[model samples]
Target: MSAGDYPQVGQGWAFPPHWVRPVPGPASVVTDHGEERIERSLQVLLRTLTGSRVMRLGFGSGVDRYVFEPRTPDACYRLADDVRRALLLGEPRVIVDSVEAVAAEDADDRVDVVIAYRIDRHRRPNSLVVPFYLAGAR
Candidate 1:
């Protein structure tokens, strides 16, 4: 049977095969139901944002370029744009609804991003929040 045909290991979000480890590792190799696909997409987004361009053979559009700059209003806007673009290029399964960057009041070099997206399979939206702290940023 195909990956989708297998039963999900649990309710709610399904774990992707790779993310689930075998026995003794707490995680188990489960079926990639609809939720797993979205989970994998989020994982890919995180990896793409943390990685740098040319670091991978075929995939690029990393958001690390904006991490070193000062966390100004304009800089946050640029970071959001960069993240949106990266998501578009890296993960095609989901549609990017909006990317909003907000300055963290607790730190001058920290910013929080709220990502709104819609998976192609459904009309309901999902949101992901990522916090970035640019230590020693100029």
Candidate 2:
């Protein structure tokens, strides 16, 4: 879908019930379509945006691995792998679990652009906010 189809920009996937508080397990929703959602969101944002404003994702170890990988010298095709993995196994937890991992990953350098999961409910001292400020500055 296109950015217009998304309706909201920078907002990533929601944590499936599995990742929810008091039960941080495998959220079937997250386990099912999290990564796909993120990849699509990034694609849509990149297509819709005017400049290279960093992308911050709240993903997990898997999300951090591929999306953050410097595949084409300057390009990080992280979601490509995640999508592949999901497609291969027909899973979503891996994708959704990675959604919260965005705080650790360096996308847009902040917690605003494409942040995923429970950032508002689980803000830590080191939670990424650089982009939030940068976006605000602009």
Candidate 3:
């Protein structure tokens, strides 16, 4: 989704100016750490990653918001499985990497304020399995 369409992901607020947000579903099954908890963890991560200038945040508006992420690659498949379970009111940024990829095209790669809940370790395998795997492509 375009940056202007999503306010939570790329709004002119707490987020970095260059941190473009991704639009995707939330985590599931393997990501047992409630979505709120996941967001909280990511918020902490955003505050901790001292090298990135942009951070992708998955924070939703309210309780109805199904924004979450998997901390490990092994959990991404399961996270995808939960896509049906989570009800997205609007498109939410998928992960911090997406923002990086999109921003890279514009010549901005200083993501020192990322808010990713976790990274999927098996992303390479999924990228190969999935036909249009643009999630981790550089």
Candidate 4:
């Protein structure tokens, strides 16, 4: 089914809310619908650090903790697991298929976290890759 078929997915203000001007109209904040909305939500969930939210102290991923660690196999595995767990706890709109952290080809301090998921009520699977930079890596 097309994205329009999934009205239940709804709409949300665009992440990092940007403004766009329409023809002969004032600028308006961007919005996202259907799958795009879900993807943005996932991005926000993953980027947020646990305990950073004042009212929802437990509402974020723990992957930020790995920023200072070496990107070894063990650290990668742990980061991936943390991402999976965070999604399971935070996003009710998706079923996480897998999460993996792979080193960037030309950057020793960077890891690309690949998240495979299926949106609820959507047939096709989707994946997102979030780049993670290890601050302490040399």
The local distance difference test score of each candidate is 0.67, 0.31, 0.27, 0.87
Cα misplacement distance, residue 128 of candidate 2 (Å) = 24
Clashes of 3: 15
Candidate scoring better on TM-score of 1 and 4: 4
Worst 10 residues of 1 by lDDT: 1-10
Off by over 4 Å in 4: 1-3, 135-137
Could you give candidate 2's per-residue lDDT for residues 8-93 as a string of tens digits? 23344443334443375553333323234544433343233222344533222233333333333122234334433432343232
Winner on TM-score (1 vs 3):
1
| lDDT of model 2, residue 131 | 23
Q: What is the C-alpha RMSD of each candidate to the true structure, in Å?
A: 6.1, 16.0, 18.0, 2.0
Residue 122 shift from truth in candidate 1, angstroms: 4.1
**Which structure among the candidates has the greatest TM-score?**
4
Supply every candidate's count of residue pairs whose N, Cα or C atoms clash at under 3 angstroms. Answer: 0, 24, 15, 0
Q: What are the TM-scores, per candidate, against the unseen true structure?
A: 0.64, 0.19, 0.18, 0.88
Instruction: Using TM-score, rank the candidates from best to worst.
Output: 4, 1, 2, 3
lDDT of 3 by residue, 1-138 (tens): 244333343322332223333467643232213233334334433233223335433422221111232123433333333231221322233332321111123322211111222223322211101111223322
The prediction achieving the highest lDDT against the true structure is 4
Give the alpha carbon lDDT tens digit for every residue of 99-119 in model 1: 998988877788888888876
**Which residue pairs in candidate 1 collide?**
none
Give Cα distance to truth, residue 3, candidate 4, Å. 4.8
